[model samples]
Target: MSAIMSGAISMGILAWIWANLSAAVGVSTWAGFMGTTTYYASGERFIKGWVKGMIANMVGVLWAIICVEVSKVLHVPNIVAIMTGVISFGIVAEAKWKNLSFVPGVYIGCSTTFGMLALNGTYLSTVVALLMGSVVGLLSDAGGELLVRLTNKKETEENLVEKQG
Candidate 1:
């Protein structure tokens, strides 16, 4: 089977599992999906990509929280807007660090955090869901690779047998 087909199958299965698991845990299913998407979009190896994406996401959440707190303290009409602008700058600026270079992950995390807060979701739950989703992403990639390797091995064996016959 082609790598794309194998990956699609793996992703589909893992996404279904993540959706069910996130719902059972009372977390945001969409957040989990976002996490998985971020993992794949990261474009690094498994461990490196997962770590960088998670760190960037948590930093985004922290920035959003800081923006909220600063907005509350400033007492200005546009404090929220100002703080958002500042925090956004900080979020993108952190890409100077090699580990937090995944700017999209940071943005996704920030947006998801804001959405969760609006819906009265806890930070802990958000983190948990993201972590689980990242795990799913890792598993899905591994599973797809495994499938491809097994298929290739079988094909090679069959080809060798045919040549001998």
Candidate 2:
């Protein structure tokens, strides 16, 4: 199978498994999906991508929380909007750090935080779901590579047998 096909299959299988497990565990499946996507989008190796995505996501969540708190404390007109702008700037500024350079991850994390809040979900649960998703991403990637290797080996063996025949 082609690499793309292998990767897609791997991801599809893992996603299905995660969705069922997450639903049973009361975790946010959506958050986990986002985490998996973010891991792939980072385009780094498994460990590096996971670490960068998690860091960026945490920064985003922190900024989002601060934005909400500051808006509440100030109680000024359009304070939420103002705080959002500040947080947005902060999120971008965080990209200066090598470990947090995945800007999209930061944005996704911030949006996920807001989404969780809107759904009356807890941040801790969201974090857990995201972590699970990242793990799934890693597994899916490994599975895809393994599948490709196995397929290649089988093809080589068949070619050798045909030549001998």
Candidate 3:
């Protein structure tokens, strides 16, 4: 099967088993798509981008949950949630981190935060769902990597057989 298909299958099974995991499913799907595209570019680049994207999604979701939880504890107005999310993004953007250079980490944080808040999800559940999503994305990437390797091996074997026969 194709790498994208592998990722979809992995995430699909996760979503089917756990309804809450759907929160991260959209990001996971994109990660799978990006992974497949990167693989076409080069195997090394695929692995690097896939890992970085998954990590960024996890960090972003965590940061967003933190902001939302803080706002809830402080009894702040709903507007504060937006401010908190944007500020969190700024902090992440300015921070000195190698992985931050790739992936839309800030956007991920902002969107996840706002989306969860808009949905009126509790702090704990929101965090749990988002974390699960990130893990699923990572798993999907690994599946994609395995598919690529298997495909390459199969092609090599076919080429050898053709040359011999």
Question: How high is each candidate's TM-score?
Answer: 0.94, 0.95, 0.53
lDDT of 1 by residue, 101-134 (tens): 7889999788887888888887777787778888
lDDT measured at residue 16 in model 2 versus the true structure, 0 to 100:
94
Sort every candidate by TM-score, greatest first. Answer: 2, 1, 3
Superposed Cα deviation of residue 70, candidate 3 (Å): 6.6
> How do the residues 16-126 of candidate 3 rate in per-residue lDDT, one tens digit apiece?
644443433533333223323323222233346445654554565566666656666776567575767566666567557775544354345445556666766444444
The number of clashing residue pairs in each candidate reads 0, 0, 0
Q: CA lDDT, every prediction?
A: 0.83, 0.85, 0.53
Q: Give the top-scoring candidate (TM-score).
A: 2
Q: Compared with the true structure, what per-residue lDDT tens digits does model 2 show for residues 7-114?
A: 889988999999999999999999988888788888885788788878877877777788877887997999988998988888888778888778899888888888
Better of 2 and 3 by TM-score: 2
What's the candidate order when arranged by decreasing lDDT?
A: 2, 1, 3
- By lDDT, the best candidate is 2
